[model samples]
Target: MQPTTPLFLQKFSSNAPESKELQRLTSFENVENKNRDTYLDMIRIFINRNHVYRRGHVEFIYSALKNMESFGVQKDLEVYKALIDVLPKGKFIPTNVFQAEFMHYPKQQQCVIDLLEQMEDNGVMPDYEMEDLLSNIFGNRGFPLRKYWRMMYWMPKFKNSSPWPVPSPLPDNIYELAKYAIQRISSVDVQSQITVYQTKEIESSIDDTWIVSAQAPSQKDLLKNHDLKEPVYVEGSFRIWVKDQLVNYFVLKRQPKQHIKTIKDDLDDVSNIRTPIFSFQKPIEKQVQVMQSVHEQEDGVILAVCATGTSTKDSLLSWIRHLEKDGNPVLSDALVVFTLRTGTREVATVNNVEQKQIESK
Candidate 1:
């Protein structure tokens, strides 16, 4: 009924070539997909180029810094600062990530510290989390955390600030990282200068002071060794109560004497045991005492004489290795033996140690 259409036009219309519908189809599917791919590629490029968020990227930066060290410390520091600028804060990353990326080698850690110290000296305050992260990383070796914490305590900075955030669950790889790091740190004889600020408003109203008795040697004889019987007084507005004698003895043992040969030639090398005892409240005081006890009782040698759980045994061996790294001959010597505990045992004899080792094997 209609006028006859041209053959070419008829075929084009029937096949939907270059028609409104065909145009719509192309716009909806192919064009959209291509745009999405373009955006995704761009994002990938940004992340890869930044270098801080990615481990490989940061490691490469570290490598470059190491190679540049011969040029100058300032040059290396600049590289580190430039790299740190890209990494955003508050991101959840495993502790091992930092160790792997930034601290795997000793030179890398030293470079980072130098860079951070430089930044700090430049009057540009860094992100608090960065400082906390570094302190946690380098602190155990006794280099900076104690000093940093004490300094922070006195200064207006970090007073109103929230407590440093540590990851709730530690990652698995950090065990080996921490093991080696702790061992390396143990080798240095480090001391921290703690400046505590105390107010009378905080102490409990209760006046209960517990007196702990000594067993063999009485208080008078022990008094010659920085008398534990006397209440340890401090510059701060707080009273110290020596609740446990054993714990007090352990702590006081480290204090330097005038005539007796000191563990460290300088008197300043020793920590002020009086500070923790005088400043802390009850529960924290107890914790400090326990730490003191552990510090005192930890002998250099560990023998795998008895069969314990695999994890426990491995931990002991690791501790022994750490002691060896610290230059403790007792841990290194083959003469030191591990002994199983017996009923009413005072000290485990060398024979007992050998017998126990054989039985465990």
Candidate 2:
């Protein structure tokens, strides 16, 4: 059977309002003097005038409903029903304003729950969908669910077509059970490894009329001298494992280099020392070399890695971990380190390196 279009979508025409009309209607001040019915009509116009319900319109409607009392416009049950009916389909509604406005009154609290129930009853959202949304709102806010047990009861009813019956003698306190379920649903696993290495630069220092060679500084000396025109390598390897199996691994490295120059006493002296200008090509080339060697040793096994700041790295790691939780591939027992800044670098290890699995949620 063909599914029916959701009522929220059916109430509106596909044609969007002209830019001038939308601009005028969106200004809440323009309708401030109008009666409550006019405000409700404005909401209906905003919903029906657009082909797709814009988030702004939904937010505006929510804002108006929340501030109806302050605006000296008492909203009736009909108005609340209309607002619920016109809510944007398949989108998250910001609940802060609504929660603050309605939380003080028991009747208003029931009204908000009723509106959500109506949306589910009208086929706008499935049972599980509504539960997920409500769970986020209630669970995150630490709202007591004793009065909203009906909502909690609705959670176990929909099991994605499982033939198994609901557990008999369900926990006496279903709210606690629901909270646990929500936590499990929302939890995630993250696996990360950070490797830091010290590097040194081998170069020559110039003096007046003389080219003097300087011995390469040790790692300790390079770290101590921040003004040195040398680079230090910080490499991080992140692997996300779910359900006790490795799904993804990421490799990243960064080198910080700086150069300093001194104005020679005699510009005419070609041998005079000049400030060093650092180049990143060496570090990049060395990283590429290490990657190539690792790939060759592993027979072209490739792990996805991105280079960015710590925030982006964390976001990607979290996103990949949350995507899927079941996989079969075991993490390989190989460790690769690219220490281009220092000589005698160990590029790859086949069996020498130990493999550890990390799970984050």
Candidate 3:
């Protein structure tokens, strides 16, 4: 004696139902009397109302499929096509539910393949937004290339199909070489010394004012190389190129023992100092600066020397020794020296000076 309009349609027509009408109709008690056609009609209505297939809708569809099986309702191709039609454009299908529903059904699987092929034939390639969603789903699940090979295989037909554009490779030249040097220096462990080499273009006219010191230099000593007439030193400080042409000047001051102590103290409490500290200071910027300096240099290799103590001297000596021991062709030919100043008297020692022809750029 129930009204003939059907509870499902009545609820669907309402402005806003209390709960999900599709879910309620598909429940055990209500779904027992509903035939396959009734179920298809419900699905169609649900799809029409909610075009976007979110996780909740996907779950609902999955439940509906299971309920249909229990009621001995056969799913026709039209039913599946309706399901695919309702799939939200540029949105990812819930992988777990998606696989569970279709992976075992040979017919449904073939339907999906045909749908993709039809899309390709009709020149309907997935746009960037859709590609991004697919990438997240596939990447997270580690989906094999062959699993979606059809999509990739047909991608070349459409322009702007590449979801992630790759930059062209850099030319093999001084700029590239400088960039590589910066990268190498930046990637080195913090406790390790950073060693960068000069390009042949800048090596020829490198300034000879650089001097190694066992201790911090005095303000007068620091400014001694400055031309008084032109006044290169601004307040007894002059900028020098450190990484390539990225200029940073050193101010004559006592060693920063207090700052180093504070930094060490702050780091001591951290369980993993390496990752937090290193990641916090992005080194890629320094590398880019080094690369940019290649075009700005007219002199020999610019070494933005900082006045530190025995540790730095030892590290430099060790690096020079390593190059010599390894028979490094580029550095082996160059003269490496250390000048120690002892109260107005200077003592110079030639570290390494073996001449060899630098390879042509």
Candidate 4:
């Protein structure tokens, strides 16, 4: 015999052939629609293909979990439940305490646990039926059931908790997205008015896109009172998410005025009171000064906020013109500047905006 073989070098059974279930899932890459029906159909086919023993289910589920986003079903609870139901009932459950603690059917249990983790990541809460499925597949002591319990306890508390609630399954149209974005942005002012304008209506427009704008009545007065010589700026390629979509919006604003912060309490001042000869003291109603509005903040005063179909300079020029026509004719004399930036991260000044205005004139 050859020299005594090292224990580490001893031959072990070679790994088994590639899993057919995984191969099938890999082939699903050709699918284009990525809709719910297509995803469920694939699951049905897999179940039928492995009808008898449903072997390789652990790998199949892992593959399915990975594919959920592509199928646009990652946030869907029913799809997640269907994924959990793939496991055969009463099969992986441990009969002994030792088995339960050690993680009975380690591969299968771990696989389902990972699936539950995916659901949690996607903010998908499992329902009572999912609890029952986990109980049947991995029993009471299973880690996945514990994960499910934790999720049920926490998810509902956070759900619908946002004060600025956008519609679920956010609208696909960019105009609709822009409206929702403006609505959220305007939540700071209860009296904010949202108006939609078309660039085509602006005669000199180049980029044909919709503009959704929000401005309160107070903001309009602020614009009217704005110094005509001091140029107001169009600021931003600023971003906000309408659900999953990235929306680019711009603000019409002015630099914050530097003023001393004053906190004068009138509570101690009794100078305005007149002592009535007959009965009691009567206070004369003094004329109150018109205070600066909520829009007038330490930061720039926001005149108006808008999202345009094309966030390009041309569309913004059109937005300025639209504002001029809508009640604030003072924009006719007020010079508008642009602080638009380019893709190369270069900040562009008013040259382009001025040029566009000149060409329009």
Best by lDDT: 4
TM-score of 3: 0.24
Segments of candidate 4 deviating more than 4 angstroms: 1-22, 30-34, 49-55, 95-107, 262-292, 343-361
In the range 1-361, model 2's lDDT, one tens digit per residue, is 9976455435444454456656566556765566676667666666665555454544555566555554444424445445545544433333576654355334323545655454344223233443444444344332323323554466446534443223432344433233233222222212212111111110121111111101112221222332223222223334332222232223322233322344334447769444447543332122111122121122222222322222222232222222112120111122334332223343332223332332321
* Candidate 1: segments with Cα more than 4 A from true spot: 1-104, 132-361
User: Sorted by lDDT, highest first, which candidate order results?
Assistant: 4, 3, 2, 1
Candidate 2 is scored at a TM of: 0.23
lDDT assessment of candidate 4: 0.77
lDDT of each: 0.31, 0.36, 0.37, 0.77
Worst 10 residues of 2 by lDDT: 207-216
| lDDT (Cα, 0-100) at 72 in candidate 4 | 85
TM-score of each: 0.18, 0.23, 0.24, 0.75
lDDT by residue (tens digit), candidate 1, 21-49: 33333222232433333323222332333
Clashing pairs in 3: 205-299, 205-300, 206-299, 206-300, 245-293
The RMSD of every model to the true structure, in order and in angstroms, is: 25.8, 25.6, 25.3, 10.1
Clashing pairs in 4: none
In candidate 2, which residue ranges exceed 4 Å CA deviation?
Answer: 1-13, 90-361
Q: Deviation in angstroms for 314 in model 1?
A: 82
Tens digit per residue, CA lDDT, model 3, 1-361: 9656465566555354435655665453465566667667766556545333333455454555556445544324344445454445433333475654444334433444454454454334444443344344333332321334556666665445443222223234433333333333323222223233222222332232222211112222322332323212001123332222332222112111111122223325667455765586753322111122221124222222332112233333333333333323323333333322222211112243332333222
